[model samples]
Target: MSLSAHGAEGAITNALTIDVEDYFQVSAFAPYIARSEWDQRECRVEHNVQRILELLRQHQTQATFFTLGWIAERYPALVRAIVADGHELASHGYGHERASDLSEQAFADDIGRAKKLLEDLSGKAVLGYRAPSFSIGTGNLWAFDCLAAAGYRYSSSIYPIKHDHYGMPDAPRFAHQVREGLIEVPVTTLRMLDRNLPASGGGYFRLLPYGVSRWMFKRVNAADRQAAVFYFHPWEIDTGQPRIEGLDRKSRFRHYVNIDRNYAKLQRLLGDFSWGRMDQIFLPDQQAGAAVV
Candidate 1:
């Protein structure tokens, strides 16, 4: 049930990732959020995530939830709910801060805080992390050493594309080893001739119709040698959230463009490919003998 099929047989085993954060809580939304006005709006994010939980449960699928330490501290019940449902839990840093905003020590402290909080609440080892907004690229690759030192096994933080906000234009597409014994599971992209297209499923998928997402993903499989990782937030399907203010037209368009159609499109994806956790996708080839856990 990992994201690609098991990364054997020349393709990926299925793996699903849930980045649990509110719409108002994303770093992109931070600029407009006055700290004096923020708190756990449990009504919005928690309630909406329960919808995601319902979908996964309905499909009997288990996923890796990259959660905010801020969310966990305020919503311990929700954290417990995810763990109790047998889903894997991972970190999304503390307070939704980006890796670039912190010094090396600050980032390490944030990771530690999140890890300790998640472990204490869920009673499980938090082995994975994802920097907010794909914030670990060329200049900030040093964050990897801190993550590995903080006892993380893998990170899903590199976008490997040139986005206005973040990306590592020259990073590898598939999973590779980092300097700190950390595995880099970069977002999926389809390479055509010399171009790396966004096959790592995300807002691009939500904005487009199911046919487009399906077509591009199929092309990724047909061309690329492994499973293309797909990620979407629970709020992407929650069309009823309050319309935000202070965003430019581009942010407004990207965030809310195809809300009505996304759920149906997601239903299509749920049926299209097998979905599981990171632990499952990166499962070693037993036939090849265990390299390391």
Candidate 2:
């Protein structure tokens, strides 16, 4: 599909992305669940992902899956299934380590390991990387350099908003070249009354009214003339997954609110707009150059 087509008057194909990690591995739950105990916890990621796949299939849309190396290692078949279904497979780093918390070298190693593992399993070059929890920020600008050096062509790691955990409020709000050849696609946000509002997906999609989210994307497409990058995790649809206890009220709210309603909201979002794989929408030319293992 041509980029201009999406940019044209009535056909705007936004980027739909899935952050493929289990509920237990989420950053909000990191404080409560130790990484060492990950294997012991019930894993609902495979089924949750399959559900997402079915949803996408019903809509006949493709998306980018920023899969965790941990998940890919354990569910190689699921990773293969994603590729087999004609979706883009990208890296979400191994072990879900935050970029800000790791040294430059450690961050590089984490992405490198995950990228290679994903490429091997999916038999496709993993050209994109997203920091776990959108953790790459002003302090860790070196993360982009690491990504470029490690053969990544683009990154969707920054959220241009003010948040306690992660955001680079001043970063470009659309896809743009960051390093010499690397592109940084910040999460979609709307500028209203001189403030940036989160319109991209995630818990924000769950917490906010569906109409508001729909309006934001429509405004972005109609006024800004740019495709929005919408994202969510697999576990968002698995409302039946076991819940963790003792999380502060804020964490609980952010992670669990509107779980039962998200799947339908996603269906509405899917039907309202055109969608495509990230590479197809943003890095079209490089697709042929994607690494082959």
Candidate 3:
């Protein structure tokens, strides 16, 4: 059934997304681990993702997996498992390369390669794309054009909050059209005291109390009257995964803080909100004639 069909009057069905990547592939560790060395690292993604799939299955929820081509290539069956379980498959680029770090041609090539690969593997037309680390900004507004040209219908790459690494503070706080045929869905945030506060999830979800996170989503639904887009990496749920050393205290905290509580918090999150895949929540019209998964 479609998201609209599942909801009551004025009920908001938020988007639940997973960034499918391993522990070492995170941007925080990019300086420490090279892409060439990615193969040498121990892979914990398959098990972590399986755990996620099981949790979602228990909740009877669906989500979009913004996967890396690198992971899909190595774990094709895991990719198939996600599709088999009635979830949406989207591109998170081939190598988890940041959009801002790549040239125009390189970015195009990366997304193009990843999109084709995922579509071929899943036997589904991948319609969404999210840049690694929410890296697209004003300088790369052209990335939207690139996405449209590459056959993507929309993107969830921008974060409206101000962050040291990535953010387009002036961007739309919710989903909106970027180019003629492409939509840009910024990560959900709440406006309070004239500033956009991080509400959607990730480390922020881990760092903040569950009550605060719950209140943010409640406000977005009750006051703003819009669906919230929440995202977290599969690695977040794997508290037992190996950790890197020699990092600064801040990096250590950002990556490791609240690791143990993630699963329970996620359980609460899944129950607190009505969740659905990104395409289902944001592109219902485009998905109208498509086969139900």
**Candidate 1: RMSD to truth:** 3.9
| RMSD in angstroms between candidate 2 and the native structure over all alpha carbons | 2.1
Over 4 Å off, model 3: 1-6, 288-293
**Deviation (Å) of 23 in candidate 1:** 1.0
Model 3 worst lDDT run, 10 consecutive residues: 1-10
Candidate 1 at residue 160, lDDT? 83
Q: How many clashes does the backbone of model 2 have? A: 0
lDDT minimum window of 10 residues, candidate 1: 284-293
How do the residues 1-293 of candidate 3 rate in per-residue lDDT, one tens digit apiece?
Answer: 11222378657889999999999999999877778888899999999999999999999999999999999999999999999999999999999999999999999999999988888888888889999999999889889989999888889999998999999988889888888778888888999998899998899999999999999998988887788899999999888888897888888899999989999999999998899999888887776224323
Candidates in descending TM-score order: 2, 3, 1
lDDT of 1 by residue, 13-127 (tens): 5567888988787666777776446663434778877888888888878788999998899899999898888787889998778898889999999999999999888878887
Alpha carbon lDDT of each predicted model: 0.78, 0.90, 0.90
Candidate 1 matches the true fold with a TM-score of 0.91
lDDT of 2 by residue, 105-130 (tens): 99999999999999888779988899
- What is the alpha-carbon lDDT of model 2 when measured against the actual structure? 0.90
